[model samples]
Target chain A: MKTKKSLLFISYEEARHICDKIQYGEATRMEQIKLFIRISWCNISRKYTQKNTQLTTLCQSANLKSLDKDKKDSLKKMLESKMSESKD
Target chain B: MSSNTLDPTQWIDKYADYLYNYSVSRVSDNEIAQDLVQETFLAALKSSENYKGDASERTWLISILKRKIIDYYRKINSKKGKAEVRMSYNSDGDGDGDWMEERISDPHGNNAEEKIQNTELGLAIHECISKLPPKQAKIFSMKTIEGYETETICNELDITPSNLWVIIHRARTALTACLEENWF
Candidate 1:
């Protein structure tokens, strides 16, 4: 039996995009509902959602903080000048 | 010989954040952490020729960073001298003891086991991030780790919101897959 195509249904690709958005809290309520429905019976989408959720949890608990842009830029410039000086 | 080499100029571009995160977790100070990363890069540069391909570039740099961190602690300890603790007895024979705060667990210090776990997790995430395409890596880092706004990232990267989303989706998928094996 084939699952009928309907306007209300979302494709697995869109479901994945929505899953990514949901990770960042950017997914709208409607998108979340659609994703919820899609993965309810879709095995592939469900597996993707499970892994995506696990990834989000790992990132949150990692407690990682990146250096700001200014620091990174200055560090790069300092290394560049040092490298050039070494060659000379 | 295994094939691994150092690129001095890409040191900051590639490993600055990774090294910074590792050092900050250990040193618990941002300024000192940044200094250690810079010193590690410079030291690596001075000894670039001596680098054989036995270890990956990141691993070799980390070895140097570990030394820098240890040296930092040693210098501070030498400057301050060995810690002296004095447990005093009250002259009137009342209760007196060592520093009261030292007797208590530090609330702000965070639990040691959890901190160690987070540090390891953070390092793993950074390692995977390093393996991503340059643009994808930058966008993902800015959006996810640094928590930049979508519009802000788009304008900075000169890409539209949709394009940003596409890159993020790809990067996230790739990152999750990579981490699943190494981390989970």
Candidate 2:
């Protein structure tokens, strides 16, 4: 009778081989699944990152537009003050 | 946008095959694997400014792909109404009869060697891998199958070294058990 340890060792070796077969394309279904997951992941991340950049850009533009509006308001106030002082 | 400016398409042409092979090795599905690779390239191109060269371009792409895989599984399992179960073998328990019997039966049988030699072994492995819990399978495939160094795997997976080792050990043990039950 084989010891439990020996049996475990054999099983592990077999498992590694099984894993290798899948890795090397010896199994079609497994290969397909692997590919599918990878492709899906790549696509999802790509879209996610793209959206992130767009969002950032939008936020930056909004900030810039607000800043510009503030600048224009300040200029108008300065001109009004000078006109009032000259009229007085 | 210049005519000669390296674009996503050019990068795809250069790295698609490699990325495809790499993704296939992990997820084992052709269309999905290709999609992942394509997406990686697209993401890289869109976020090119974020590329700090801290990692190789390929490595950065793979890291993104890995995150995508995790998200996919999370979405899948959640949809199926199955709560993810995390199990660990204590390695000190009295060997369970079912586990021992499983080891003996070698469900894939002695013919496993022949199966391993067959080209379809890749597919079989992929199927088995898919059956694995998402994290375990990812770590196992990335480390053992993809031949990534442990440190790199840790970085890509965003896990600490100790956590990485623990996960790998659990993954290998689980895979071993799985093979015994299914592939023999």
Best by DockQ: 1
Please, what are the lDDT tens digits per residue for candidate 2 over residues A1-88? 4674443332323333333334323435644444334435465433433433333232222221111223324434544454466459
Tens-place lDDT per residue, model 1, A9-69, is 8999999989988988899998898899999999999999999898889889998778889
Docking class of 2: incorrect
lDDT of 1 by residue, B72-105 (tens): 9999989767777576534554434544644576
Model 2 chain A worst lDDT run, 10 consecutive residues: A59-68
Cα lDDT, model 2, residue B183: 51
Q: Candidate 2 overall Cα lDDT vs. reference?
A: 0.50
Residue-level lDDT tens digits of model 2 in B1-184: 2222333323332334345555665575766665565556555555666766667555676677777667766777788786667756555566665665755676666665553343233433444554566677666666655456767878877998667666665655555555446553
TM-scores for chain B, listed for all candidates: 0.85, 0.43
Error of 2 at B96 (Å): 13
